[model samples]
Target: MNTSRILRTTNVVLLLMGYQRHWFEKTSHRFRLSLPSVVYIFVLGVVYTACFSQHFDKSSSTLKVLKDISPFLFGLIRVQLALGAKAFAYAIYSSVKSVGAINSLLKALPSRNSQFTQDEASAYLLLTSTFGILFCFAAYIAYEMKFELPPLPDAMLGMALLLPHFILAGSVRLYTVLSWLSRGQLKELKKNAEEELRANLTKDPGNIASAIFTVSTEGLENLKTKLEILEANFCIFAQSLKHSMLFLFAMHANCLLGGFYTLTYYWNTWYVLFEDRKRRIFYAANASIYAFIASDYICLMVVLFMMENERRNFIEAIDLLLAQRKLFSKKLRPIAKDLRGVLKKKCFKFGGPFQPNIIYVSLMVCLQIIIVTLIVTVHYLEDEISLLKEEFSSTDDN
Candidate 1:
């Protein structure tokens, strides 16, 4: 494979796995931790010490104890979540790599017509640059969290986490463009076949039946070749897609837990921070980071929807070919039948069971709404409780 082309056409799912591995190795080089890793460890150690070192009274209320220890809990949960996501990504990478000859088959497909138009290229560039800027903003927030100068290491870690998202977005854009080109080629081939029939009729009027049969045979051959290549590509994609779904699920779970902790346990602190002029920038930065992460997840889901749509298009194209019952040769009929059978048997599924579609997207949106509703409810209840306590104390004084 041409290294540059591979990078350009790289699957985002695989790229994420590679980034995880890269991050791990770079941070733990020679058993010496990177600055970010060191800071993370130190902060975690301090939290642990505070929890166990009798800094708070042993008889404190359960809620008070939990409030003090929530940071530690959040950190532990996030680390485990990161590990789970990495493991899932690795599994997906292995599955994709094990598909023999698929890589070369992908490369063998004609590339002449696959070049992106200017508008398509600009759109992709804009999307990528937008994500890149969002990630940089995230890195800035992460660094500000520690009040550190020369925040290069923290910023790099933030970029590392987002690297997969950037690559995935670019890959999806490229795939869409390539699919468009393929469809255009099929249309052009059909037009050419019509012109060929007209020419043959003018040149040899008596052998019309033979000329038609020959033209039909050639057209079937071309269509069959293209379908075969596409089928192989989809097979590889479907397998990797299954693994990607797993990773996405794991990440979603992590995000849910982290978001819950932030809103439930740290909301007061966040509100106070936002009220301070000097700290308001940090608050906004952190909020933006979370927003971007949420958006990235939604974007990945959208890409999967697009991929599934493309799969349907391939099946429809094959169906259209088969529909011309009188035109296809006996050999061509069997080829089309076999292709349809393969597609029927292999489907892209989530967690090896649920097939995702528009309905899945709807459910995800509803879930987010429910989570936000719960957060708002909690905040309201807390406010009411504090108000009641103040009223009771005022009554006693009177």
Candidate 2:
């Protein structure tokens, strides 16, 4: 699947976009920060900050359909900007330190007996990344046309929107690739163990000692070592993105809330749309924007949950292997024990405090729905009270 080439290309795009300081050296293929790239990222952040101020200013005036929700929308925009900047900063600073770990994984992949088999994983990454970029550009043009902002500031703001998605896709792709590789290694180890057991059983069913003797302790130890290294690397990877992930988690919730609020507002004002054509267009555009952002958030969440399942499978596979060896002998017990210890360590988790699992994600979704309902109810009551007040004032005058 040309995994190395994919990594090389993606890494270069990230570097050029000012998301990362590190770049692969052309001849040596070593990962190190490029001086120019670092400078460019710094400047890019400064410029984005400046453009966002203008964007925020324009948003309040130009966006008039949901006046009450304007403040919340503005806050969402600010959070998006913050998420992007923080993600970029962490990618440049914390993640660059993991270059050595990344290099080790890269080196290990080529030496492995199995070839890359996950073309679907590669395609998923490429498609999501491409769509994210396209969405950002489309958003930039939409905002610039509607707000009549200058090209430079508009483009900068667009890139701000692009950064989080770009960083996230890259992070998930790397993690997925690692998880797949680890699973492949586990498969080979299991197969090796099974073959030894079968060969011994054929000679004599009661010769458990023969099976234990034939089992390569060295190979078991090596697999254990590899898993340990991968787990440590996962820790580093998680810690590196800790702060950034906090922002991203918040960003997702914020997006969902904002999208729901916008949609609900439009739903309530469905009749009002007939009075103003421009307002109708505005409502549709905002709905579409929120929908696009929300879909991306949801898709990413699902992918993470799927990855979580992959992690669970890894632990289960270890248990199955251990169970298979438990009856062998006292000698096999230590090997089983060591693998069990590896299972005890916490593997990589996404979204910082808000770990991606079915329960937590479902709870979060339910909570958002409840919050939106309360907001809509309160807003409706306020409108009814205002209408009653106007009628009472008119009655008194008559």
Candidate 3:
């Protein structure tokens, strides 16, 4: 037991050191905040969490309300509330449009058409650069709360797990650019099939073979028939999954990080309430919660940046493919299919049996970044919020 305990302690120390390295090194040094400040915030958050829980325990009415909502239900509600209707609508639009547009681009495009459709000239790759800057207000909050929490190990854990998701999504976006290859190949194959039919029709002089070849060639050898083969297949959707998967990773990471922070905060609050630390604990809990909310906002802004990059990269690829594109030498456009708001497809069936790839890892990484950003932001910003609010009010008055 003693040996096991020593090993655990050593492992934690090493992990903590590694995390600190990333925080200082990987995070742009220009944005680096003070470590001492962060520690102070964590300590405060811990004390507050403890007090809040103690108060809640004493308040039978509040305890009853909390008990009425299960963890899973509460989590779902929180997610829905946080995202809002606009966010959900945006998600639906993006998912449907991107999928359908890619499908159309693939169907009309021959193999090797990825080069043409790729919109390399797009100024929008940094689509949210301006918008993202606006969200930096969250950082102001993070900076203030830096002294109220514990080790922030949970945030670190979340980030470590989710970083892979971002990379995976980015990789997939890169692959989508290669659609030109698919378009080109599709075109070449159809042309060959047509040529073969024509050749056989002319050469089979024997009445029996000639008649047979002519009948078969009449319908099958036509441009429309051959072009139909290039329609977007489920296989294509499965193949184009790099970015969406990365997105999923980002979601998972945020959820985990949020959950961990909430749980820890609640646990501490409960402990404090049990210890009869009422008002002080409530103040602490509120501070941590406010900081956490700010941090989450910041992390989401980062995700917006990643997603923007993916979209820009995708458009450029499509435009590249579009340039050399020749999908239906005999044109036949597919009508738009009905779309839905919900992700109603059964997970196993929709995703298909393809083994998971680096996309999964990429998504996980994005998740980790989001979680860590929130934990740190919330931990750092709690203290400054009071003065910040006053400044905001003053600005408003002026």
Candidate 4:
């Protein structure tokens, strides 16, 4: 409730928002490369070539190709649409970057007394634009579902499956910016308090106790307010991100196991079919793309987990500062006690059910590898048993 606290909060909010705006701007700039669109076009061309080069009769070839590769094609379309939404969001954010317009918009909001800085206004606008893009994309998918009979259901299902991931991505971005701002504010507050205490002690050494009490009390209050704000606004994002990470972890494991299963089951057939140069090229390209996607998902989850860990560490550092007895006077000790109580009661954490530290991350990686290895071993055993059965039957016939 202090004036300095309000100013600091506002400044941090604005800084966090500005970071989002700059991110969108950079993303928009990158979209100029049109890489996603090019990838989509390239994928489409590959499908077309693969479909036409088939030696089967036209009907059989068409059906066979569609059956075999429709999932990949649909995946490409979904990815392209998501990229298009990103580009659209970037455009919307870029068009509203004028300071006057942003300020006016913020002033028009119901919380006008909050005096949202221009940077905060820009950040809110960018967030709104992003949501707008997501809404439009969802609406378009629903609209297409009303008319398109074949791919509509599949497309809708895919969107539904990916919605959590999209939410996690947005939340991660917002939480990261907010975390950085919080850390910066904490550092600044500590530095300013130290300077104020030094000046007070120099002026009147006898009043050092009062200066310490005042600085410690104010710092505790500021830290509490910041944590409250973070908990209220950003914790949901962290929770959602945690859920998304777990989901991705499960997904990657499934992909690994499924890929091994498919390869084992179809190895002989694929070996014969892929003897053709074009078929081998197609298979390799498709496998590489799938591998890249899976790897990217894993990388994203790792980065998000690491960021969450850093945020938790920052909070712990503040807790450590409060625990320092030398920094507190007798009169200010109760305030520090209260701050510790608050922290104990409402500590911000990244994971639910399991703590997401380095050990957890390493465990997840090892679990996937172990599962994949076990699956491959089982598959090999099955193959050996089948070969042994064939040899026994031939011997009996002889």
lDDT value for model 1: 0.45
> What shift in Å separates residue 75 of candidate 3 from its native position after superposition?
15
User: How do all models score by TM-score?
Assistant: 0.55, 0.72, 0.25, 0.48
Clashing pairs for model 4 are none
Ranking by TM-score: 2, 1, 4, 3
lDDT of 1 by residue, 55-150 (tens): 234454542544565544436343543554354345435333433323333442443423446434433442354356676775665565555453
Pull out the clashing pairs in model 1.
none
Q: Give the TM-score of candidate 3.
A: 0.25
Clash-forming residue pairs, model 2: none
Kindly list the per-residue Cα lDDT of model 3 for residues 68-162, writing each as its tens digit: 63343345434533332223233323333344434343344332212323232221222222224324533443444553553344333223322
In the range 1-398, model 4's lDDT, one tens digit per residue, is 12223323433343333222221122121112234433543453354334323322344443355447434333434443444334334422432232223222222121223454543543343234434554554455445445345343333443433432342343334333333333333344445434433333324556656665555356556645554544444344344344434543554454555455445545654456544544544445336434533444444344445445555454455456545545435555564455444434322444457455546667777878787779678767876798899999999999
Name the 10 consecutive residues with the lowest summed lDDT in model 1. Answer: 21-30
Give the whole-model CA lDDT for all candidates, comma-separated. 0.45, 0.56, 0.36, 0.43
Name the lDDT value of residue 332 in candidate 3.
13
Q: Model 1 clash tally? A: 0
